[model samples]
Target: MEQHTVVLYGKPGCGPCVAVKAALERAGIEYVYVDVTTSPEGLEHVRELGYQHTPVIETSDDHWTDFRPDKLAALAKGLGS
Candidate 1:
């Protein structure tokens, strides 16, 4: 199966971001990390998503903010096959 493209929007030292990244890595899910702290476009994207926090996870069909273990697991499992 084709690998899912996961985009993780976060900052450099966000704990939830770290946790999310770690979870994705553990699940063997490849992802693109977007550091909103470093790029103006990244920040703009987050704002467009109507979020004011870091650690936003977005796939081609879905997006969310904060840490959600169940959602993360589902994304990993869905794409891992």
Candidate 2:
């Protein structure tokens, strides 16, 4: 099965972001994380997505505001559990 690409935009010390990543890792899913807080392109990147918040998890096809267990699951195998 082909895995979807996950681009997680988070700040330096976001608990929710950490939780999301942890869950994904526990599931053995692959993902790329981006810290928008310290990046100069943060505003531009988020603006393009029409979202103005940290911890915006982006899959290849969609964006999840929470990226919690359920949200990550949706992007997991078969859109998650």
Candidate 3:
């Protein structure tokens, strides 16, 4: 498994983040969406990965800043290996 779980760290008014979410939805991916603007835990989680913005896509083994496609794939697939 490339990821144990998919966590999408997002904030309000982020267009790219929104696109990322939409892509995930369109791909039929299951993920946990967290609004960092409202959740300190969410911010702290991604902070460990050095991301200081919204929409930090994360898995057990990967962190996607700015919504990368590979990250999305890993998120959709998960840590099954």
Candidate 4:
């Protein structure tokens, strides 16, 4: 499997963010967590992406907002190959 980087930009106390983190962990996917509340750059990057919410997930080939199990499944499947 080719190594891919996943970055999760989220703030504290976000329910979806917590779910996304748990889903990624359950999928055995390693990811870097950026607290947007503390990281100015991360907040700027998420805003630049046109998202006004937390739990912004960015993979090597795609990016999305909110807790999406289907997307996480696809990411796992892609990484498995």
Candidate 5:
């Protein structure tokens, strides 16, 4: 995979957020974890993206909310190119 950035916005005690983090780690995908509850910028970013949920994954080409294994799989596949 070429150079890329993936940001995961989440808060503590969020189940889906934990799942998303695990999935990404298992896929060997590097990501930045931003605690929305602690970071004002992270909170604003998610709000700007129109998401009212945790585990909001943001990449250069795409962004989505919740623990989407399908989307995560797609992202892993795309990284091969």
Candidate 6:
């Protein structure tokens, strides 16, 4: 299977974002981290996705807000190849 790119949009000093980052790290999943606090484009992208929260996760097939371990785990297992 082709490997999918994983992207995480977050801001500094956000608890949920921190937790999500930790979970992804523990799951051994490689991902691109975007700091919306510093990047206007990143913040715009998060808003365009219809989210008002930090820790927005985006995969080729899905996108969601906050920390979702189950989804993260599924992503790690299914797309970590």
Top-TM-score candidate index: 4
Cα error, candidate 3, residue 53 (Å): 1.1
Q: Could you give the candidate ranking by lDDT, starting with the highest?
A: 4, 5, 1, 6, 3, 2
Clashing pairs in 1: none
Q: Could you tell me which residue pairs clash in candidate 6? A: none
Off by over 4 Å in 2: 1-3, 79-81
Cα TM-score per model: 0.92, 0.78, 0.79, 0.93, 0.93, 0.90
lDDT of 6 at 76: 83
Q: Candidate 3 residues 8-35, lDDT tens each?
A: 8998999889989998887787778999
**Whole-model lDDT, model 4:** 0.91
List, residue by residue over 12-45, the lDDT tens digit for candidate 1: 8899999999998998988899899888998999
Global Cα lDDT for candidate 6: 0.87
From the highest TM-score down, the ranking of the candidates is: 4, 5, 1, 6, 3, 2
Candidate 4: segments with Cα more than 4 A from true spot: 1-3
lDDT of each: 0.89, 0.73, 0.78, 0.91, 0.91, 0.87
Which scores better on lDDT, 1 or 5? Answer: 5
Off by over 4 Å in 3: 1-3, 74-81
RMSD of 4: 2.5
Cα RMSD to the true fold for all candidates: 2.5, 3.2, 3.3, 2.5, 2.5, 2.4
Which lDDT value does model 6 have at 26? 84
- What is the lDDT, from 0 to 100, of the residue 11 in candidate 4? 90
